[model samples]
Target: MIFDGKDLSHRALADRLPSDETHVFRECDLTEADLWGAPLAGARFESCVLDGADFRKADLDGAAFTGGGGMRIRFNDADLIDASFTDVDLSSAHFGGALLTDASFTGCRMIGAVLTGSRGTGFTLSRSNLTLANLGGCSLRGLTIEGVRFDDADLSGCDFTEATLSDCRLRGTRLLDTKFTQADLRGADLGEPDDAKLRAFAGAVITQAQAAAILAARGITVL
Candidate 1:
């Protein structure tokens, strides 16, 4: 079923949707729409305004969300395996208890998003702004992260083992108990890591400039 250029705001369409067909919503306004437990597997949402949309417990496996979005959208407990979100505004969205296995988010504005407690082996994020986001306990192992900003975000218990970070920013990020074992952070801007944050990066590879900056911060001059 295709819903193109439709205004479906503040409506409950979960029960009315046919479960046998693939759903496609393009250029639609779904603000505050209730889609809880909706069977939306392989669904395509293109340039849709999804502000405050509730998709809790929805089956969104292999779903593709492109272009438009808004703040505080709820996706808790949703099945998002193999899902992809590109160039979307997902600010302050909630993904607690969501299954995001193999999901990909690129060029998205995810500031203040809550991805903590999300159950998945891994997910991909690139060219995204995750400032002030809570990603505690998330595993980004062995992935190549590029152009992402994690400023002031909580990364407690995150696993970045063998991951490669390029052109990323980690300014003022909380890295308590985060693992970076064998990770390459040569191109990342790790702003003035303190003792704890520095300890979290143990076994990670860094560039000489980063090492110099770290030493310089401690009042030690590198000749």
Candidate 2:
């Protein structure tokens, strides 16, 4: 149902929803609503404010959450296989322990979003803002992360095997135990890493200037 600018409680909205099926919630204010353990697979939520809403353990497979003003939304432990989130403002949202295999998030503002322990094999995050986001222990193998901002983000224990990170920002980002095996780092602004942080770039492709900058940070005279 189209709930443009309408504010409804979780119980009220849940009562109106059908059993174990897809539902459409457009432009609704579901802020801080608790939808824990709900069966909402293949549901579509467009331009809705779901900030601080709890979607823990919910079935959101093949779901689409596009064009929303939601920030700090919680999707902890949710099943998000093949889900698509486009143009959504999910800044500081919690996706910890979520199953995000084959999920896609394009043009989303995900600054400071937590993605720790999230399991995903295939995912695309294009033209998104992930600055200061936590991606610790996430295996992002072969993912296409174009034009994304990763400044000050925690990438500890994260793997970027064969991933394409073109035109991305990595200034002040934490790279402890991070792996970038055969990954492309062309046109990325990986601003001046120290010797310890330089160790994280062992198997990745980089520019000559980047190499010199890393060496300069290590007290080496780069002629």
What's the true lDDT of residue 217 in model 1? 93
In model 1, which regions exceed 4 Å deviation? none
Task: Estimate the TM-score for candidate 2.
Answer: 0.92
Per-residue lDDT of model 2, residues 1-223, tens digit only: 4456678545424446665556888888888887787777888888888888888888889989989857778899999999999999999999888999989889999999999878767567899999999999888888778899998999999989888788899988999999988988867888768654668877998888888877777789788
lDDT of 2 at 132: 93
Local error of candidate 2 at 13, Å? 4.1
Clashes of each: 0, 0
Provide the overall lDDT of each model, using Cα atoms, as 2-decimal numbers.
Answer: 0.97, 0.84
* CA-RMSD of model 2: 1.9
How well does model 1 score by local distance difference test? 0.97
Once superposed on the true structure, which residue ranges of model 2 sit more than 4 Å away at CA? Answer: 1-5, 9-16, 218-223
**By summed lDDT, which 10 consecutive residues of candidate 1 come out lowest?**
189-198
